[model samples]
Target: MFISAKNIFKNYGSTQALSDISFEVNKNELFGFIGPDGAGKTTLFRILTTLLLADKGSATINGWDVVNDFKTIRNNVGYMPGRFSLYQDLSVEENLTFFATIFGTTIEENYDLIRDIYVQIEPFKKRLAGKLSGGMKQKLALSCALIHAPELLVLDEPTTGVDAVSRKEFWEMLRNLRDKGITIIVSTPYMDEASLCDRVALMQNGKIMQIDTPQHIVGEFPRKLYAVRSSNMYSLKDDLLHFPEQHSVHLFGQYLHFTAREREADILGLRHYLEGKNHQNIIIEAIEPGIEDCFIELMTENSASNEN
Candidate 1:
């Protein structure tokens, strides 16, 4: 395993930040840790990168224990934090040079490793890192992280605040990196980006909800689903939630996504119930489940089991 974490636990004051979180990343794979904000993604990343220690369990990168071999782990992994942490006052070229110096290397020594990405922003080498656009800053940060030619790359929500085009470009850059035989372990809140990974671990609160390829996870959605819309959208949601046959009710775009209580749920009865409630222009059509849908279902199941 390129990366391995077992039963890791972390705490912050009274809150349990991570609980028995365990997963492994294979060599040369693009593994994603999918979750929303405050889902303990950053906390787990910190522990894996050796910036923080876990209260319990163990983690290793490239077969070296994170705690005991912090020095070796730090040298072998390239980490791009959630926030841009490069020197704001320094120019892009200067920042890259400084990072290379710290790692006992020079830009010329590892130029080939970052050439593809660096070329995109090379013209702005003299520009201050703080003055560059969000996308450019992202490219520069990645350049510095890869300057030392680390075998593993750990990124924490690298595309969170960037524009849509920039986000797409960033993912393309990641794919290029993966092609270079660098193992990547990234965390993101965006469900759409999950499909791009070789495998993903859906996380919520402080636990791993599920781990599988995006196709497999979506393929395993256990209930029949439908997309519902009505002239009175607000009232329609309320009516569906109150419907005895609704397993779950959630908003998706301009429509409400519903999972039926039973496979044989009465579609006509549901439409009539909405009509009786004065919800005009009613439309309910069966649809396939998405990754977000599966995530919600798993979360709901987990919460209900805990309550019982």
Candidate 2:
């Protein structure tokens, strides 16, 4: 394993931030932690990157103990935090050079590693880091992180707050880096991006709900799912919530993603119920569960288990 954590726990004053968290990442694999804010993704990343110590449990990266081998890990791992942390007043090239110098290397020495991403932002090399556009800043931050040629890259929500096109392009860069034998562990609140990872750990309330390949997680969703819509979306959602056979109902984009309590749902019966409620242009069809659907299902299951 390139990265591993066992029974990790963390607390912030009186509140628990992480509870019994554990997962592993194989070398050269692209692993993701998918969840909303306060899911403990950042806390866990801090521990893994040796920036913060865990209240309990232990973790190792590349055979180095995170606590004792902090200096070595710092040298071998590139960490791009959730927020842009480069020197704001420095030019893009200056920032990259500074990082390379700190790592006892020069930009020219590791230029090949960051060539693809840096080229996109090279035209703006002399631009102040703070003045660059969101996409350009993203590319520059990534270039700075990669200038050392680290074997493991840990990015905490690297694509957040960027345009859709930038988000797509950033993920493509990550994929390219992974192809070159660099292990990457990234965290993102965007569930759709989970599918882009080799495997994802779905997290909620300081715990992992599920960890598996996106395909397997969706395949294991234990209910018959249907996408339901009508002329009045709000009313349709309310009505479906009251439906007797509904296992769960949540709004998803333009439709209400619904699951039946029974393994086999009565679609015709559901349509009739909506019609009786004065719903117009009712459309109800079975649909395959996506990463969001699977995440919601796991979250719901976790809540139920806790209550029980």
Candidate 3:
């Protein structure tokens, strides 16, 4: 494994940021930590990158212990934090050069590894890091992170706040990197990106709700689900919430996933109920679950268990 952690725990003042966190990433795999803002992703990344100490448990990257081998880990892993921590006043070229120099290497030494990613932003190398657009900043950060050619790369929500096209471009670059044998561990709040990962750890409130290939996770959704829509969209959702056989009902983009009490939900009864409620243009179809659907199901189960 390129990255591994066992029973990790973290806290801040009166709050627990992580609870018994554990996972492993194999060499050359694109692993994702998928969750919302406060899901302890940043905290876990910080611990793995040797920036913060975990209250318990241990972690290693590329066979080096994160704590005891702090210096070696720091030198051997490329870390791109969630926030832009590069020197804002510095030019893009200058920032990349500075990082390479600090690592006792030159940009020319690893130019081949970064060329594919760096070329997109190279034309604006003279622009100040702060003056660059959000997309450009993202590229520059990625380029700097890869300039050292570390065996393991850790990125925390590298795609947040970027445009759709830029996000697509960034993930493509990651794929190319992983193809070249660099193990990558990235975190993202966007559920759609989960499909791009070889495996994902669905996290929430300092816990991993599920960890599996996106296909397997969605396949394991334990109920028949339907995408439901009607003329009265808002009312349709409200009515579904109070549905007699509803196991779960939540909006999924343009459609609402209606999981019934069992796999054999009453389609006829559902239609009749909606029609009786004056709903028009009702459309319903059995649909396969997506990563978000699976995550929502796991989160619901966790909530129910806690309440019990």
Per-candidate clashes, comma-separated:
0, 0, 0
Clashing pairs in 2: none
CA error at residue 118 for candidate 2, angstroms = 0.5
TM-score versus the correct structure, for each prediction = 0.97, 0.99, 0.98
**lDDT tens string, model 3, 135-245?**
889999988988889998999999999999999999999999999999999999999999999999999999998899988998898998899999889999999988899
Q: Is candidate 1 or candidate 3 better by TM-score?
A: 3
In model 1, which regions exceed 4 Å deviation? none
Model 3 lDDT-worst window of ten: 256-265
lDDT of 3 at 281: 90
Per-residue CA lDDT of model 1 for 14-63, tens digit only, reads: 99999999999899999999999989999999999999999999999989
- Residue 259 C-alpha lDDT in model 2: 93
Query: What TM-score does structure 2 among the candidates reach?
Result: 0.99
Error of 2 at 275 (Å): 0.8
- Residue 63 lDDT (model 3): 85
lDDT of 2 by residue, 219-253 (tens): 99898889988999988988998999989999988
lDDT of 1: 0.93
If the candidates were sorted by their TM-score against the true structure, best first, what order would they fall in? Answer: 2, 3, 1
The lDDT values for all models are 0.93, 0.93, 0.93
